[model samples]
Target chain A: MKARIRITLKNGVLDPQGKAIQNALGSLGFAGVSDVRQGKYIEIDLAATDEAAARAEVDRMCRELLANTVIEDYAFELAKP
Target chain B: MKTSVIVFPGTNRERDVADVLAAVTGSPAQIVWHGDSEVPQSDLIVLPGGFSFGDYLRCGAMAAHSPIMRDVVAKAKAGVPVLGICNGFQILCETGLLPGILQRNASLKFICKDVWLKVENTQTQYTRRYNQGEVARMICAHGDGNYFADPSTLDRLEGDGRVVFRYCDPKGNVTAEANANGAQRNIAGIADPTGRILGMMPHPENAAEPMLGSVDGRKLFESLLAA
Candidate 1:
């Protein structure tokens, strides 16, 4: 099984890095860019065969270490062969 | 008074803090490694500033989960004074000892300079030596010091008077221009309800000596020692 996670800053959180990227894009002639928010994508491979167990553990990982819930939100999906 | 300083990988300010701690306590401060599982009983536990874990996966994220933090968290809950400076502040937030997160500076650049801070709360274990509204000069060197919390949390911190320090002008005015990092409410430091855990972005240890520029930072250590 594999877990694909996407972590991002929560709505209304100020993201200076993302804002700088947006401004740079605007300066590079990329118009109509109203906003830019940055995030992280992580892919993990699990040896566990049970899909439910894998998901539950991944969720714990996100909450415990992967994502700081104070200012970030995280979502993930599991893929099993 | 005894003090223990935790050193994580890439931690660079532990010695500076130790210098101040040893001087104030009249004993050598213990150096605890991040991999250690136990924290010795002490009057104070310090998490000094540094680029912990190279700021990978967000500042202090990895360091917050190090083996030693488990014990550090337990001691903090038991009412030991834990001071987190700069990178230590980020780790405290990540560990949920302190509310909120430290994001990149508003300018998206590393900031290194002296800033005036108004003593917002003088009743805590960390700032009792200073008079209320006293302006202290401290060194702040980091790229991610912009503090952020939800609106309700901000209100609660304000209502509870947990804000220990705020960036201010020389005359003690907290103007927007005085906010160097765009921290919410210009917060430079805060304390938990028990007033034992304190996390601040400025480097007080660096300013502990007059030769190093300013002596305003030593008062914080003195306060901790007396408490």
Candidate 2:
């Protein structure tokens, strides 16, 4: 099984890196960019054969380590091979 | 007094903190590596500054889950005095020992300079040596030191007097211009609800020596020794 996770700063959280990218895009003549929010994408391969078990395991991984619930939100999908 | 300084990969400030601790406590601190499962008994447990785990996957994220942190977290919950400085502060937050997160600097730059921090709370073991409202000069060198927390949590910290340090001017004024990293409430440091755990972004260990430009931070060590 494989887990694909996406993590991002929670709403109302300031993201200076994302803001810098937006400003750079404007300077490069890319207009109408009102906002830019940065996030992370992670993939984890697992040997578990059970779909439900992989989902639960990956969910725990996200909550425990992959995402800090304090300022970031995370979501993930599991696919069985 | 005895201290234990946790050493993680990419941790560059262990010696700086250890030297200060020894100077104050009159005993050398035990250095514990990240892969170890237990931390030796000590009066104080310190997580010094540096780019732990190279600050990858967010600052302190990798270091927080190390084998030794399990014991560190257990010790902190047991009411041990835990001090996290700079990158160490980020680790405490990641470990859920402290609240809030350190975002990138508002200016999107690594700020390496001296800043004034007012001692907002002196009731803890960490700040007993300083008088209330006293401002001390410390160094902050990091790309991400902007502190953030939800409004309710911020209000609670303020209400309970857990905010130990705040960025301020030389005259002890906490104005927006004095906030170099745009931390919420200009909070440079905070203690846990129990006041046993303290996490701060400023490098007090670096400022402990006279040759480092300011000895204002020695008070923290003095406070600990007296506690």
- Give lDDT tens digits, candidate 2, residues B69-171: 9999999988789999999999999998998889889998999999999999998998889999999999999888999999999999999999999999999
Q: Score the docking of each candidate (DockQ).
A: 0.86, 0.82
Question: Model 2, chain A: how large is the TM-score?
Answer: 0.95
Poorest lDDT segment (10 consecutive residues) of candidate 1 chain B: B218-227
Error of 1 at A78 (Å): 1.4
Tell me the docking grade of candidate 1.
high
DockQ of 1: 0.86
Q: What C-alpha lDDT do the candidate models reach, one value each?
A: 0.94, 0.93
Chain B TM-score, candidates in order: 0.99, 0.99
> How many angstroms is residue A60 displaced in model 2 relative to the true structure, after the best TM-score fit?
0.6
For model 1, residues B180-216, the per-residue Cα lDDT tens digits are 8999999999999988999999999999998989999
Task: For residues A1-81, write the lDDT of model 2, one tens digit per residue.
Answer: 888899999998988889999999999999999999999999999999988888888889988888888889999888776
Instruction: Indicate the residue-level lDDT of B22 in model 2.
Output: 88
Residue B73 CA error for candidate 1 (Å)?
0.7
